[model samples]
Target chain A: MKNASSFCLLLVSLITPSLWPIIGHADGVFAFSPEQAIHVRTLAASCAACHGTQGNAMVKEGGNTSEENNPVLAGRTREDLLSKLLGFRDGTRKATIMHQHSRGLSLEEIDLLATHFSMQIRVIRPPLSPQKLEAEHG
Target chain B: MAEPFNRRAFIKAIGATGLVLASRPSLAMASKPPMGRVVIVGGGYAGATAAKYLRLWSLGAIEVVLVEANRQFVSCPMSNLVLGGSKSINDLTFGYEALQANHGVIFRHDTVTAIDAAAKHITMLGGTLSYDRLIVAPGVDFNYQEWPMLASLDAQKQVPHAWKAGWQTVNLRQQLETMADGGVFVMNVPKAPYRCPPGPYERACQVASYFKQHKAKSKVIVLDANAEIISKKGLFAKVFNETYAGIIDYRPDNAISHINLATKTVSTEFDSVKADVLNFIPPQRAGKIAQEAGLTEKDYPWCDVNFLTYESKLVPDVYVLGDSVAAGLPKSAHMATNQAKVCASAIVQLMSGSLPDVAPVFANTCYSFINDHAAMHVANVYRYDAGKKMMVSAEGGGVSISPNEKEAGYAHAWANNIWADTLS
Candidate 1:
């Protein structure tokens, strides 16, 4: 019985590696459990419209962004992200959209967002063309 | 303590690290099996968002099937642009391809016939599907009894509400385009608790902007049932007074008693106003499915739901969100999407035999354009009010100081991002 069980376990391990792509790793990017991936992605997604997708922005906030605006959030220290969000939420920092967006998030959600965004790899984005900008400009 | 949850506890419950590490699979990840089946009805902002996030949080362990009557979801948020000629029907239309392809959310292109709340199953055109948890985000439906003349399915087209988007939007655009110069384009705003509280005013602004540029002599007359503007009151009022003074005529407390379709006139209790193109938006209730399921028992025209989890107070294991639920949150795309996340989180936690976060918080930003080039917005944060049993405006949260031209771009960004967030 012990030998049969060992054989069964070996067979399962062998098959799981093969089925990884088909079942488990199908969403190849997010290997973590759905809940964690979602928790990070969804909260981070709320910032995407203005902050750029996943917190990498070519332009800054307040409809007028210059070099003076902060750098990309990806790969920043967890403490930096948390402080900025808390600043926006508590009115310590001046902002256009972030203040309104960050007002109600609990400290836990803030921590999750900070950890998620800070851990991501920073992405450098190309500038938008005038025509493309026109199309994007509502 | 309502300090909410610690990071370690949340990590332990999801077992996300353990599963990916492929260690502690026997004891840790097994604590909360990721095998709950959730079925959501409707594929609008609320439903689509719930479908996607449910899968995201469950790590695809929970099977989520979205049953939508329409193949393509039309957004009512930016659909108002169609009437003023800034956008087309195609721009407002979205397909379910991404929700299926990217998120692994299953879709059923069919309508729901009935819901068996007790059995936790729903009947569709083809067959019934049972669910461990059923989420109904059916949105809102027009109450046409106020204007009986536009009651029938055929009669409704002649004076389209264009409230639900799609063909009505096209029809309304056609009406506005074909009307003669110096024509009167009249639209009525219903009472509160309707989808998109400031939508009628925004539509009025869009039409006025178009008339100012294209049909110089034409004008838009707004007849509002409510005593005053319900949302973004100061901004909307200011825009009407300064930007669209002559082009848009807004009258409050002018409720519609009946409509004479033949003469193209609307009659109120005290007066009658004639129009060239009538866009009569009717009062709305929870979508027909919710009404049929007896979810709106208290005459509130919406299902009562707990703000934290969005579970139906009337039915066990059946949750409702968006405009269909009597949550104090405004019925806008932003609010609906936020509510959907809260609901999805709670469901996953419940499925895992863990408690949902006690003190939930989210924000809603509503952006409405005053013209093609200019826009305004109101951004407010909301917290779960355990005392009131609903979500209310958090302290120090309110509308923007004023409307601005720069906000137009931000508004467009909002539309672009929100639609992408919900659909893609």
Candidate 2:
């Protein structure tokens, strides 16, 4: 038993040096790095409902009723988009809808969404011809 | 194939490796450099708060230098009330003496001419200064050329963009004072990417409130460049419709295209509107210093940096904060102050050879006063997202008070708290 205790102590001493690697791994997991694309993709799952799969924003025939007060972010500059998201998150660009959506997001999620949307090609969706929609519905 | 590591062994391994890594040359290099100096530009909310927090966290290990072009920072946050005559400019003005005495910040009253990011040195009108880490928060500069009509000398003389603090604010207020009782005061709200998104609406509310009291015959018309006004829209509309019914007219989705200053008329994409007094808030970007440093993207002013550390991605040992950074934080004094604290803490950790485990939580409370006695507030918390390279908001974030008298009173108190927290 004494020999086992000494052996365990020796083993503990040998294992101590490896502790930094674990800490380093933890730091890697937590650190805000540029290559967290997978994590970003996972976080962006929640945004697919409104922003669409890749942030192309799925606008229904009636328009986004939930976001009627806000403009659809289909195609905008990354800087412009990021600023708006920041504003919404910080309550600087307050809207009941955006405030709720933004408040739930972490900074990482915001960055991920901003990055994902920032790279999206700007495609101007022609405004719905109101008369045509009305006639079709009628 | 390998045996499962027990908890004690795992902990011991972690502890031992931490010690070894702690003894590495790189880790040792993280120790506080010999009296490292931080030179910050701009003395507004960002710079002042940064200097204070840096001093606090460093415990007098780092030297804090603040360079400000203006003698005093006249807060742009609540200056709308000043225009409405509900408050004085004196109430908005704050000096750096308290900051210097209490925080041990070295204040240099000078304009920054250029920043040599390569050398980590900044050239100023007064002298050249070197910094271990430079924090640039020079606020914003208006792009008059964005609207050609407003850029013309004749038009500029008549229409004022009181977006920037100091003379601009005073000029706009004076123009309002000179307007006839029945004159129309036209305020233009620029599109996104402008400083203080809610500012224009807040200004309109205050102006409408003022006209109700002093210039009842005069009406304030808001021509917005965006599809919708930002923040507290329901509350603002309700208050305006109920309290200042005929005094205020709001139009969104109306982008101002031109201004015929000769005739005091402005043209938007939709229609033309005439005014006796026009306040045009043009689109904005980061300041010139940031642009010269190659820190800005195409038309956007400001450097892209790690939101948690405020460290420039392009330049090492250089931090960018406030409106000058593409931080996924609001461009408000409150957000800037929190960002300054985060940056300061990160700098401390980097210098002290210790890992900072503290998670950064940024809080912002924006208060908009509908009238002298009543106000509205919105607050939120923000955290960093490395994967997305952005900041995101918490879900189910802050709410405006539900039109209760008690809440209104609290809103007033909140405003007082904001003013004290920012300036005092």
Q: Candidate 2, residues A34-129: lDDT per residue as tens digits?
A: 234433432432232224323444333453334321243444553456566667655566554466656666554555565556554544332211
Flag regions of model 2 displaced more than 4 Å: A1-138, B1-34, B148-157, B356-358, B402-424
On residues B143-190, what C-alpha lDDT tens digit does candidate 2 reach at each position?
Answer: 766677776545655777777656566667888888889999998888
Q: What's the interface RMS deviation of candidate 1? A: 7.5
Instruction: For each candidate, report what fraction of the true interface contacts it reproduces.
Output: 0.13, 0.10
User: What are the TM-scores, per candidate, against the unseen true structure?
Assistant: 0.81, 0.68
Task: Tell me the whole-model lDDT of each prediction, alpha carbons only.
Answer: 0.74, 0.64
**Pairs clashing in candidate 1?**
A34-B56, A34-B59, A35-B57
Q: Provide the clashing-pair count of each candidate structure.
A: 3, 29
The window of 10 residues in a row where model 2 chain B has the poorest summed lDDT is B1-10
* Runs in model 1 lying further than 4 Å from the true structure: A1-76, A86-93, A103-112, A120-138, B1-34
